[model samples]
Target: MKDQITIVGNIGSDPELRRLADGTPIASFRIASHERRYDQKTSSWVDGTPSWYDVSAFRSLGEHVLASVKRGQRVIVTGALTIRRWENGERSGTAAEIEATAVGHELRFGTTVYTASAPRREEPAPPPADAPDPEPVAAGAWAAPGAETPF
Candidate 1:
């Protein structure tokens, strides 16, 4: 089973958008998620250590994220989680990353206006230059053969 996680946090950096040689877009950003505990003695909320995660979104989702997300914005991200250990010149650390499946603003922080993207439609191929034009039909001639037109 794939490991998945959902996190609500503030974006730690601006989303970086890049295109691969194949023209596929990918966006990456950092998010800081932390816990807040209410202390009755202090009568206030105390913040815990922040956990950072790198987030990546691909294709149209990446494009949308590049257009919509910004640094310091509160957002919710859900995706597959991956942890990798890397070493460079004796320095080694585990990095956490998420391949985002869904991303959106955290509504509790503020209101956001949503705009739906229009479906992409491929243009019809042009007719061949040597192709003969079909004969024109009279108005209301769309009725099937032997069927009477309602108009």
Candidate 2:
């Protein structure tokens, strides 16, 4: 996989939002990017094969995606790509996904207003001294982003 990947495409589905018991937010969606080619026989441009990516964002980035992105909206995503193979009851296939670090509206498609949010603290807040450590949240309880999640 590449160290980093940048893709510009339209959101293929609505962003699914959820929060961990501790209040950390998560957002996920699918993006479809296509290549266009000029066909001499057709005498016009034609769409080549489309590539789909299952994208996920976490914490404040996740919150931003949930609030901003929507189905069919053009956007830019910068992230890391991971590939996996799975076998389920005799069904097997490969999956491609992106762990998005940044997501935003594609300015080339149209104009959009931007509201910058405050930055997060460098150090996470410690739980109250009197409070017990909270249990980790299970991913199974929440719906996976897109058709699958990179667990």
Candidate 3:
């Protein structure tokens, strides 16, 4: 699609907030996307090119973004690209922008990590006050990491 965009990058600086004429909120930041090249003989990775993107979040996302996100944090932003035209000192230029909607933390290269967020509260009743904590499970107790699954 012409408007589709997906970006994974490190935050360049803390997000800044602005207000529209009608009081709409706008949050803007710079993202630096990096790539690495691998050397077959050396079995090592070398630094590669990086592309910078300018992103913006609006409304509630904008209001909370500045406080929740920080510079240098790695994140994945999914949104659409909009080509905006504006005049700069009598000169016109096009700018690339992503109206971010879904933002997530990206896992490391070749590694899959799942995060469990805050637990929900049950309305019926709380757990027994004297209930003992669950036993600690050993790493090997569960399936081995990267183990093959037979279907």
Candidate 4:
């Protein structure tokens, strides 16, 4: 089985979304995770070297990510890690990447409001010119006031 990686960090930049030729959506962004160590001398926690990673998410998840995530927001991501070696002239380095399977905001640091997105549905064809206008329906129980609850 392939190894999976999970990282909890702050997004270092705004997510960029794109579509492949076949119309598959993808979103890419950078994340920075840091380790803290306690120092007896200063008696305080200090940040160690931060690890930076490139994260890519695809399809509907990518769409949702683009809409929900933003720079500096804490997030948790899980996916397969990919390492690639590269060289240019006399310089060489290894690139770290994650093909993200899941991504979401980390709520421990703050609060967020959750709203359900409207479901997608195909519209019916327009009625004949002689057809009467459809009657409007009243908002149902689902739309009742005070329906939203804090997470």
Give per-candidate clash totals. 0, 0, 0, 0
Expressed as tens digits, the lDDT of each residue in 16-97 for candidate 1 is 9998999999999999999999999999999999999999999989999999989999999999999989999979999999
Top candidate by TM-score:
1
Over the stretch 1-151, how does candidate 2's per-residue lDDT look in tens digits?
A: 4568899999999999888899878898999999888999979999878799999899889988998889999999999998889899989988778999999898986989899787554776877899987777566654532334436
Q: Give me the runs in candidate 2 sitting further than 4 Å from their true place.
A: 120-151
lDDT per residue, candidate 3, 38-74, as tens digits? 9898999986787777889998777667656779888
Per-residue error for 124 in candidate 3, Å, reads 28
Order of models, best lDDT first: 1, 4, 2, 3
TM-score against native, each model: 0.79, 0.73, 0.60, 0.74
What is residue 48's positional error in candidate 1, in angstroms? 0.7
TM-score of 4: 0.74
Which residue ranges in model 4 land beyond 4 Å of their true spot? 119-151
Residue pairs with colliding backbones in model 4 are: none
Q: Considering TM-score, which of the candidate structures 3 and 4 is the better prediction for this target?
A: 4
Best-to-worst order by TM-score is 1, 4, 2, 3
Q: Write the per-residue lDDT of candidate 4 for residues 1-151, one digit (tens) a residue.
A: 4569999999999999999999999999999999889999999999989899999999978888899999999999999998889999999999899999999888899887777677666787989999998776455544444444344
Judging by TM-score, tell me the better candidate of 1 and 4. Answer: 1
